[model samples]
Target: MQKVCWPYFDPDFENLRERIYGPTCRVSIDNESMEDCTVIKVDSVNKQGLLLEMVQVLTDMNLSISKSYISSDGGWNMDVFHVKDEHGNKIRDQRVIDYIQQAIDTTRETLSSSSLSSPKAKAKVYTNSTLLSSDHYNEHTAIEMTGTDRPGLFSEISAALADLHCNIIKVHAWSHNTRLACVAYVSDQRTDTPIEDRSRLATIEDHLTMVLRAQPTTGSQRATPPNQQEVKASDLQGGEGTMTNVERRLHQLMLSVRDFDEPASESSSSPMMPMGLGPDRNGQNPRISIEEWNEKGYSAVNIKCKDRRRLMFDTVCTLTDMQYVIFHASACARAGYAYQEYFIRHIDGSALSTEGEKERVMKCLEAAIERRVCEGFRLELCANNRIGLLSDITRVLRENGLAVVRADVETQGEKAVNAFYLKDISGNEVDMEFVERIKREMGPIMLAVKDETRRQSSSEKPTMPFPSLGGFLKSRIERLSHNFVTIK
Candidate 1:
């Protein structure tokens, strides 16, 4: 059970009172539900990344997801999953089940705390920026954007595209020194054509400009500016609600570079290369090198690897998960390879202080880079969008013993064109026979999703929450003030 602080009586007491009485999330595992698996069911309020968090917890518990059904009605979320222990049997240990429940309960407590007390930042206005035009080839129209980096940046841009009815095809984004640069290839979803309307393009640009300069609606930590401005008292008092677990985790992990105002006591004059790791002379494999700038109080990491979709996202995700706060970073691809450099320190505002720490980090990074370069299978799936489709697909992948190294999931014009880069459980290449087996197993499931979509369209009445600009604006504001999710 989560601890409660019941010391004071004020208007804020309502929040505490509610927490004390909030609906308790029920998590239970039934060992006899399936022939050889356990069924775990969870009933709770939904939030962004909730499914992912569940999957992570299960994975950590040595359980493999075989099947899942996720649905949300009104505001409540009901999720059920069929899973097996590492030995491919039903989980019968009461202690393990209790542990799993506790982990999930902790996730909810963290979510609630963040939503109740997250800070609000003031919004800034930005000048209108010109949208990019296509060249002679005209493959796709691009929207090139550069802005101050902040939490929920991706979600904000996605919301803007959805509002404009622009379909995103592909996106490449990079961040460095508190700035983000993104280029999105997009189309008009309704027309299925390149965005040609000048007014519409202008509106798209305007919306993104507003989003770029806007205060973060999600409770992710605000990116500290160079001056390390303190949060205003009013901002703390008037926090927006409905923060996600991911945002809160990020807020806890990230320490803005500007917070480090002290000079380093020691500095390295030469670049530090990995002692036992190096790229082949033929340049067939990825390479990683780490150098500590002790005087500057951070480490400089350099990576050279094959460029692939979602590579940047994966790299950032790994660093963030490892509790490294990036102070400056840059990446660029050329000649079929990517070169990335990062200056980073520990989350606690300490440098990699010891040889052991440096060595461990270097080894972990090397393994990560190698896993990306390892031989893998790629599968592309396209279908009309359906609720919980991604969750289903991810569960299928896990059930097949395939680890997803990278994935790009985007929906355009109500159609989702997704890509998955996968490898076997041992991080080795999968054979063609295994690939065929995956396709054969997933074929029916994919077909079923499509059939379900058609059936729903034929039998159910459609309703729009916002049918006019007034309602749309109101809904947008409410969403922004609460939990804002990316449209995809």
Candidate 2:
């Protein structure tokens, strides 16, 4: 019998290895790999939430990940992503490539500097504006609200802010499962500065809570009691009060309120479930499955749904916030559908063990994906920013019998660039005549109808089989081995 020699483990050797390779982050972009997309390769020292940081960077740039392979183990991470622009063309712009490189480099530096901190501290550093340039949470007051959603809820909320002498600088709102979550950035209307008066902030919060508590007559039944409605106001000035990304905050708020729970009256005919191209060609809704991988000590999550922009970001963000760590994952978009698989374990290194936990995960993932669905016509408005601009616009929408399913409001310099996904009050398609009349009434607002069909058409191309988990893992291993051989 041959004797087997076991390698000795040394603490000093481990410390030396950390010193040698801990701060290394190498990102290479290959535009010539495949004819359809750009291949991005990243190798770095692994840490919690690193995958999410990278994915957020790419998705924020409006880039689509057509395919990707992720691996993070043994204090190192390596990932390869096949990405394309929104136009379904290979990335040929040098400026965009350089921007991605810079963003990744900045991420690496931030992580390195915060290496000694807790995982939560590192997450805060990455989520701050150090890696992504955002003006939404700067020099403004942020108002967060979660309650039952209704048709004219936003109109009333905006009116309350306007009455409080607060100007809406930007707002992001989402509705799902008969619940609404929104974050509105507002400044003092007269001073154009953050709202600092505690009394006034209290008044604003109280007034909005009343509006949210007001029941809707023609939508899904209100499940939560009026007294339980939540409204929070805080100054988002520089320093310790900085908030995370508005969308992520919205997700957190919704999850905190347990929006994933299916209401008793929820149905396909509910106004909250606006009909459109949300379902795939086969008329299938988002399918999510979670199974235990006992061999690997991880829970495998698989999701299949209609592909859309920022899909990966939404899923990964939800998982990270839920205290799950993704160890290996694969994502691919073929035809009009997205297929994603993730092997994840709790932060405590335990796989999901209960059926109830699996059900909750599935529901949460489904809700996250549905929150960002483009359900109605996208109306974009670009005009000069003014004290009551958002209020005026939303009032027009409400008066015209249109309801905003989703909205993105932003201010660039003196310009208020806002986009709203609009449907009729009954959740039916909006009348084009109404849109035309509103365009004429709102003079100089520069309202235009975006071509939603173009996006749908882009996904209607050729189809391909989604790679199975076994095949994906095999290919990933082969690719990693090839890289190791080249390095040696």
lDDT string, candidate 1, 241-299, tens digits: 12122222222212222111221221221111101112231246557778888877778
Global CA lDDT computed for model 2: 0.69
Q: Write the per-residue lDDT of candidate 2 for residues 196-219, one digit (tens) a residue.
A: 665665566667766777765645
| lDDT of every predicted structure (CA atoms) | 0.51, 0.69
lDDT: which candidate is best? 2
Candidate 1 lDDT score at position 305:
75
List runs of model 1 lying over 4 Å from the truth.
1-285, 294-298, 309-313, 320-332, 347-349, 367-375, 384-488
State the displacement of the C-alpha of residue 28, model 2, in Å, after optimal TM-score superposition.
1.3
**Candidate 2 ranges beyond 4 A from true positions:** 1-22, 112-137, 216-220, 226-244, 266-282, 431-446, 451-488
What clash pairs does model 1 have?
264-295, 266-295
